[model samples]
Target: MTPYEDKTIKDSLREERKKLKDMNGKDKLWYIWEYYKIPIISVFVSLFLIISIASAIYSNRFETALNCVILNSQFTSESTSPDDYFDKGFRQYINLPEDTKIEVNHSMSLSFEESAMNDFTYAELAKLSAMITSKELDVMIGRKDSIDHFGKMDGFTDLKEILSPEEYEKVKDKIYFVTSDETGQKVAAGILIDEADFEKKTGLLIDGPILSVMINSTHKDTAHDLIRYMFGL
Candidate 1:
């Protein structure tokens, strides 16, 4: 070979060796993935964080929905305003106040038996129709008192025997029936209306299935607001 060609070949070999030596050890290992590791790890971490946040938010929403249903079912009430009352009518029975008084009084003069009976038969039959037909009064009597109906009953054929025709009509359709005794008689003689129909018949506000005692004694604004929110007012 010529000396000039041999010198050029040696120089090329030396340059290649220097480049390989410079890239040895940790530097070579780091370069293998240096351009991609940081971004890949960052993307995975970000995805995990986002998924965790979404799961937490979903769990919270489920808990909230469950709480709302439970509260609404337990603390139903009647609305006082005409508009609110109608809105609640399809869902509940309501007792109305004759007038807002300094002292709101709830009377419990009758039992579930009496209430039921009064709903189906007049007081006269209760007093004197003991031997009437089986379907005459027994089947007709309701099991509870009508508090919101203001002690009223509609389609009560016998109420005129106890009340003036005018008085009976004024209060009958507005009556609410409750089980006279805690052991209610299973009489299906009274009117069965939805919340709205009850309100229309009685002129009262009602929300859910709360007891009479609770309705008369408790302040209803919070219960009403909760119901409105839960059910979407």
Candidate 2:
């Protein structure tokens, strides 16, 4: 309205503009402090640096350097005890591409005798064997000497009792189920199968506990995946 009021407002605007221009002419850091400063920027910067360092270290770890991980391979080892060494060794063997099917032979019974090591109580092993046969995936099971044992244990008896005759036949003898007791040091049986067979036989889409343990003692994640896939969890 009034000329005087307008002049006063214009003077205030000029002063503000002068201050902004002066600030812009100063060091960029100073300008940042003036108008773009954030209270927690320092914290965010620190966190970013920390995460970057951690990622670098992790990427260079021995395991990472070795490139040891499973993709889609399938394998088996004795599931008697939780031997971390054997489990790790097995994991190293099976960690492959997602296309790799890891089938595992697992015996549920615990007979100490070499002949009875993979008896019927080992329904898990039977199921795995069935899975491998059904999927026609290459499987490695047992130990060095147990290939013979695997041959003897072949049948539709146990699996047929639990699954359809066709299903049982599908996995009857299609696995390289070994019985390498490793000088009687390892358990009697475990078998490997494809992921599809695992889902069909165990009704789970992931590696079951028996197979997971054989792969790695720390394969609880695999076990969880198996359960989750099978149960829709």
Candidate 3:
């Protein structure tokens, strides 16, 4: 049979469909794959490239002003959105730009006790380590043991360095000290939030929460402002 030399897309589709209609299941599948594989693969590749570019743009669109993680807390985003109070209020308080973003993550939960450690706890710990290493973490709010664990690793910035003399004096009584494993010297690693109206201000409730700034945080001034804002210093 002589094939049409100038077949249009519609004509080709029609011819292919007619051929497929006469074939059995395996033969039809093979024929379609042999003929249509390139187009199918092209469509998927285009979609993947579009998605990758879009994701890159979306992720870089907003500048993160502050990133705070609340660990081992009973707080849930479902119960109270951080946008309603923490993020909104802080942006307003600091007079940040509209495009700036604040993150208040309370989903992480960890326990140091061997019996309490599980896969989820390990995963959260790994995530926390990565965040610290990347300097994505600004502030960490956790209990004494949790703070101590990171403190021993020298993960937190010294309060004296980040805080002014007057600011340090104000919170000196509430400072949480930890013996650094490297230096074997006591360092002011965290601030005890016992006296602060933390729950009232941030809409988060956790007993004996300690606030510590990451050693490599890029937003130290903002982190300092946050500490003073929370402690009312």
Candidate No. with top TM-score: 3
lDDT winner: 3
Error of 3 at 189 (Å): 0.6
Model 3 ranges with Cα > 4 A deviation? 4-6, 16-38, 76-80
Error of 3 at 172 (Å): 2.0
Candidate 3 lDDT by residue in tens digits, 199-230: 65555677799999999999999999898777
Q: Is candidate 1 or candidate 2 better by lDDT?
A: 2
Alpha-carbon TM-score of each model against the true structure? 0.16, 0.21, 0.84
lDDT of 1 by residue, 1-233 (tens): 88656777779779756865789688765764575688878999999999999998765553110100001111124534333433344223323332221111111122345445564345433432232222212112122333323223222222223334554355455434443232343211233224554345334334432222122213233333332332333
Root mean square deviation (Cα) for candidate 3:
3.3
| RMSD (Å) per prediction | 22.6, 18.6, 3.3
Ordered by lDDT, highest first, the candidates read: 3, 2, 1
Better of 1 and 3 by lDDT: 3
lDDT of each: 0.35, 0.38, 0.86
- The number of clashing residue pairs in each candidate reads 28, 29, 0
- In Å, residue 23's CA in model 2 sits off its true spot by 29
The total number of steric clashes, by the backbone 3 Å criterion, in model 3 comes to 0
Instruction: Estimate the overall C-alpha local distance difference test score of candidate 3.
Output: 0.86
